[model samples]
Target: MEKVELLEAVQKEEENIIRWRRHFHRYPEVGFEVENTANYIAEHLEEWGLEVAKNVGRTGVVGFLKGGEGKTIALRADMDALPITETKETDYQSENIGKMHACAHDGHMAILLGVAKVMAFHRKFLKGSIKFIFQPAEEGPSPGGAAPMIDESVLEGVDYIFGAHLHSLYPVGTAGINLTNMMASTDNFSIEMIGKGGHAGLPHESIDAIALVFRMYQEIQLMVSRNNDPLEPLVISVGTVNGGVATNVIADKAVLTGTVRTQSKNIREKIIQQLEDKANFISESEGGRCNVQIERGLPPLVNHESSSLMVKNAATKVLGKEKVFILEKPNMGAEDFAYYLEEVPGAFYWIGAGNKEKGMDYVMHHPQFDFDEKALINGTKIFIQTLMDVWN
Candidate 1:
């Protein structure tokens, strides 16, 4: 289909797309418990006469639309929500208390469904096969959904894969495209400091674990700033701290939990080692001992050059050259989609969903985050164009 006709077709289904998004938004599920969400998606795909596979990676769903004997392309969307209560007062606000689609997965699903709808109707014109992947637990449980799906051979025989994240960082009508390292690697660490407990009034009688951890936090920040090269991006942040139970007593133990984000593997390894060493040194110097635990997470998301070129050309064709934004820097946020790119040549891009004038500019994971619904159509059109550009 031509760009104008394809856009008009998506516009015709705009209301249904919003309806599906709101339905999923109201009943958000987290992690691997997205059974109902997966069933809903599978039902739609099956209804469209596509071959469906349920529970490929525990709760993920995959739909195959085979048009001819050619290369297969996969389009992916995450199907899990965050563990946050809905604070928005909108009518479609989450009915599942304490779980919300704060990261715009609902929009992602809607856009993919819109693509499925368009492609299913125009299957006769398609020259190849398309796989629609509804992945679960992207918000995370260790290595995340992508890894498990890959283990199940989700990328088997796939030629190219494509995915997009909806973001508020850019205003609506712009798409962020990058050639490499679109997101950072995420790794988490925890430190436990142990010391002698005593009355708060008698400081000399007790080794202060709280003070040791506090000092270690400051030292870790300094280590990141002074040890790494200025050109390399690295960040270490302590997100949680826990210690004493009583105000009048010196705590015998304290724990610090945080995450490390870096674009360089060597720097990531160096920072992890430095963090453990620094924590141990600081605690031992202060008459305490420290234990460290690091849980390595998803690798940095790097966009393949050929796949990125396809995305850029597709976006430019669908939305014009002015609407496509070539991002100069990658985001510190990490995505499990990195695992998919590890095996298959693919690119992950971003769709602009923020509209400041509409009061829809809240960042991801925020309680009040939302987007202009029109971006769903924009994303669907871009996805369709990318598929056509690739398969033709």
Candidate 2:
């Protein structure tokens, strides 16, 4: 399948692709409450001649296309939107108020749906099965859509799973991927300090909670600098800190909240336990009580070498070799798609959606974030090429 042939085929259905994307953009849903979104996706999948299964993982829809199976491959598109109020003015701007598809999930769903329609029409040409997975809660309420879908045995016969995310950093017509370690795991930690409050004028009358905060900040940096491996990428950032009410008063309580990111699971665990140890040591020694809280988030996404190579070859075939390139390093950003790669050998790719000329190059999660719809066609073509090449 040459790039021109694939592009032409996908372009024929460009109107429906844009329509789907705009519809999702206008009416966005967040978390597992994507009922209308799930139904809309299911209706399309069912009408496309694929066996549709709804509520696979609580508001998630799965379309099973059994095309004279050899090996089963799952294509996933996230269905959740972010909890951001739309700031960009457009015809398809979010009407759902306070919810927007700022992460380009609207485009992801549109691409996969477009691929499904094309694959359904050419079912006889396929040698294997394709599972169209429309998942919910990618932005999360913890344990994201991928985990629950896996728990429901969504990948029971799946041999290789593939997922793609729209990246605003890359320009239109280019796709980027990493051979391994596509993204890092995210873990959250919070420290609460309690001490006796007193007037600032009285020097040694009270144990200061604010003092413990700085001491613990130094200890956290030391943990990252001295305890963790330098070769491995690790980041400990305190996003928020709260203490003290007045300038003349010594605060009795303080709270520090932040996130920890790492690609290696072992290193992530080590750093997490070390944070608790460090916070406890500093607070107790300062005659103050401290409580530590930890929340584990998505696992690191590491792509399989063979699957990655296949995607690279398929991408090269669809887009020129010059348009396809390997990423230099893994991203510290987290993705729930990491869950699917854990159970099945798979690869995740970046579908470039940035277009500064059209003013669609805002970074993801920003209220003004948007993407070039032209990239949706490339995403569909790449997916089509990847599947079709499997049988070639």
Candidate 3:
């Protein structure tokens, strides 16, 4: 079908897509424990005449639609929400307590479902296979759902893959895509400081673990500033510091947890090595001991130029050339979609979901975050058009 007809088909499903979004939004699940969410997705995919597999990555679902013999292409949608209670006063406000679809995952699943239904309807005329991946735990517990799904050989025969996010940064009708280095790698570290405790009145009797943590924090910021190149993008953020029980008694131990963001692997490794070295060096020199642990995360999201161009072309066709934009810089936020790009040629683009006129421009992960529902139709159209571009 032509792009216009494809867009019209998606428009016809806008109501259904919004209905699916509201259903997922009402009962949000978090992390790898998305049982109801996974079941719901699998049921619909199976109903659509697709070969559905549930619990691939513990809580992930995959739907396989075989078209004519050709390379297999995959489209992914994350199926997890945040651990926040909804404060939005909408009718579809989260029915589950302490869990909300603050991020656009709800909308993402809806858009991908719209694409799946439309593409499956044209299955007989398709030139390639379509794999619909419903991933869980994107908001995450280390490694995330993408890695687990990849470990289960989810990308086994996939030739090209595509994923999209409903972004609040752009207006309601524009799309932003990147050709290279779309997002940074997110890594975390923890530091433990041990010292001797004493009464607060006795100045010379105890070694201060909190003091040592302060020094280590300074060194971390300094390392990022002085040890690394200025042009390279790197962020070492100290997120949590826990220590001391009483104000009168000196603390014996302190723990600090922080995150690292970097666009280059070499830079990421270099920063981590320096962090461990400086932390231990400073702690031991001050009559205290420090232990640093590292948790590696997703790699940088880099889009293939050809695949990204396909996305841009599709966005232009669907939303008009004036509405499609090339992002000037990469995002500091991390996404597990990076994992998929690492395995196959693919592109991850942002769809404009913000609508300032309707006050629907809240930043993602906020309690009142939501997007213009019209963006759903535009997103599905882009996904379908991109598929047509790739398959043809």
Best-fitting candidate, scored by TM-score? 2
Candidate 3 all-Cα RMSD = 1.9
Residue range 280-369, candidate 1, lDDT tens digits = 888888778989999999888888989998898888887789999888788898999999988999899999999999889998999999
Stretches off by above 4 angstroms in model 1 are: 1-8, 196-207, 244-251, 283-288
TM-score of 3: 0.94
TM-score for each prediction? Answer: 0.91, 0.95, 0.94
Clashes of each: 0, 0, 0
In model 2, the number of clashes is 0
Steric clash pairs (candidate 2): none
TM-score, cand. 1: 0.91
Model 2, 1-392: lDDT tens digits are: 55455557688999999999999999999999999999999999989889999998998999988977577889999999999999999999999999999999999999999999988876666789999999999999997888999999999999989999999889989899999988999999889888889999984999899899888988888888988888899999999999999999999999899999999989988888888888888888978889899998988889998888888888888779999999879999999999999899989999888999888889999999999888988899888888876656
Q: On lDDT, who's better, 2 or 3? A: 2
| Candidates ranked by TM-score | 2, 3, 1
User: Candidate 3, residues 47-134: lDDT per residue as tens digits?
Assistant: 8899998998899999999987777889999999999988989999999999999999999999989988988786654788899999
| Residue 174, candidate 2: C-alpha displacement in angstroms | 0.6
Which window of ten consecutive residues has the lowest lDDT sum in model 1?
1-10
Cα lDDT for residue 153, model 3?
95
